[model samples]
Target: MQNPAAATSASEFAELPATASHGPLRIEYRWVNETACDAPIAVFLHEGLGSISMWRDWPQALCERLGMRGLVYSRPGYGLSTPRPHDVKWPVDFMTAQARDILPALLDALDIDLPERRSMWLIGHSDGGSITLLYAALHPDALAGAVAIAPHVFVEDISVESIAQTKQLYETTDLRAKLGRYHADVDSAFYGWNDIWLNPAFRDWTITSELAPIRVPLLAVQGHDDNYGTMAQIDTIADCVPHAELVKLDGCGHSPHRDAPQALNEAIAAFVSKQK
Candidate 1:
């Protein structure tokens, strides 16, 4: 409740036409400061199991701080986007695939052009943070800057342990019902992320080596109290991308945006300002 927004953004669905990689997804999204014609755009990437609504007013609050246009959306298998079929299990490189394929497709579907992309910034959290880094590495010139909060570049024991616990909570607690308020197909969203994370093959997954090519201004953040990961996540990012700036919030958790929104906003705003 500390982070507040005066603007009331609204959501709309963008219908992505079929692409060779994957498509025809109906993505629910919201725009902030859409009428700010000359301002740079900030496209938000939600965390794994996150959606447009799950973001709450934080995106709006941040965009207002930076005086930038913003776009927030639900990924294909989550939120109000086309839900994943029950039989389909996500591949190990699903996050990368989203950065490489789905994001660009969504931007195209929304008529965001190369010029706009060059001025855009990606603000992602958790799994969305991973996607932001992947996108930066894969398409360096496509965006002006990026902020990755609590991104995982490699699979860690703590990550697996926490995820396993989350799976148990999902099954035994009211977590499903809680998340259902944000996702259209709660089971599809929950299982799609949970099953793949718990899969044995996912233990060897790592994207730490793939970040050498990212040239955009990047800010990597993590909370000291995060149950889902450790400071090593952002430290490893600094190791891979030497130019990256890091922010470690002491009293925060897995979701820095929720735990320390003001600090997160200040870090991002300062990072982007330096880029300018």
Candidate 2:
């Protein structure tokens, strides 16, 4: 895999030298299969602690399989994008703001045309998956289809416990050094997500009611073995959106794209084909 924002590649860094504006934040993004303009556009949203490099090549593989162009980007405070201010804590509504504000602005900055947006499909994982649900709910007309992999609609005890444990791993182990390969400011990426989830006030966070407005073709997917959350996350999604379909993968952990790529890709391709 090409080192994503790794220390080794000055040429790779040069390729993504420009930044897009999402208000005060400078966002870094990369295009996959840009030449395939005839196909629909697939925009990938990474997990809470993820960046563009963390996604590796799954975006390309899935986009090729579905005959779509892909957009993969690092969120502000992650990857080569603008780092979050050390003193600032992400608000509970941060994911909502991403769906409502930052994503739209990034698309605008990229100058993706309306025709592309009209034929857009969003594929998001973990925290990004929740953001996808929010985007579809808020802008029902904006998407052709959406696939949310391992999304959290509401905070759970297991989720908190896992995140807290991850904090310990980050502090006491080489997790930070490992993640440093993908992000310019690993702490900005890690703490922005960690601080908020572990906050006592954030325990009450849930988008269950907000999910009712999602009118786009939707798929809620999760691995049966996901340690961070239970199947109830997607189960709750199905309850809110009557039309939403669910996929539960066995022998898979949190990262389905890596753990069960063929299964996830096939499910997504089949789901998108029906959209046409």
Candidate 3:
């Protein structure tokens, strides 16, 4: 792996054309350790309410430590990317749509050949983590490994309750102002995620059965004190994927990357190194 002291460049944007399922969108992305193109590539997927900027320097820091190239991007409705249409309400299978449609489209636009090049991995957090699992399961041959932090395999009552509280906070607190710094259209980004997760019909969401198809190594990380989800999230991954590994961190919440960057980085680096 490469040392974290290596030089890197600033973040940039790329325009992805419209696909049958998704409209044209601009993606804000950053390349870490660009000089090390020959090394493996790791894609960082942000959480339900996260954006590329919200990840701060962690993605670059982790990529530099692993001596690998990293791709960190905000999904269509987040960060500097395009906003979701006002009339559109995200479907129940929103994450599935991301994994099966948007993600592949974004990668194709970026010219990342997954089928021909197998040295790629996905590091996703929260909703992003679930997307990673779905993608990895659907395209088992395209990736080498995956790391999911605070991912939900099934919706829990706590998850819905916490989301409800967040909705209240967004309305009552400065949370909207704080989130505006990260998203281009805060309402689009927030409602697209919040509405679906808290939807009455979405409470039945579960991806455990879909996980059985994953063939690559997986590292599932969760915080013991996570208010949004419990250890059962990663436990489900381990139960479905025989080669899956779990890391439970204490004194941490839903966002492990933010709550425990040092430990999370080390765990991810070690896991990727072992896979290599």
Give the alpha-carbon lDDT of every model: 0.89, 0.87, 0.87
Clashing pairs in 1: none
Arranged by TM-score, best first: 1, 3, 2
- Residue 231 of model 2 has an lDDT of 99
> Local error of candidate 2 at 38, Å?
2.5
Writing each residue's lDDT as its tens digit, candidate 3 over 68-142 gives 788888887898888888789999898999899878777777788755337788999999999999999998888
**Of the pair 1 and 2, which is ahead by TM-score?**
1
Winner by lDDT: 1
Model 3: worst 10 consecutive residues (lDDT sum): 1-10
Model 2 over residues 1-276: C-alpha lDDT tens digits? 111332122211212233342336677777776667566788999999998889988998888898878888888889998898899899998999889878887777666666678789999999999999999999888788899999999998999999999999999999999999999998999999999999999999999999998989999999999989999999999999999999999999999999999999989988888877
Candidate 3 residues lying further than 4 Å off, grouped into runs, are 1-7, 115-117
RMSD each, Å: 3.7, 4.7, 2.9
The sequence of per-residue lDDT tens digits that candidate 1 reaches over residues 12-49 is: 78898887767578888878766665778898998888
Q: What TM-scores do the predictions have? A: 0.96, 0.92, 0.94
Top candidate when judged by TM-score against the true structure: 1
Q: After superposition, how far is residue 172 of candidate 3 from its true place, in Å?
A: 0.8
Ranking by lDDT: 1, 3, 2
Score candidate 3 by TM-score against the native.
0.94
When 2 and 3 are scored with TM-score, the better candidate is 3
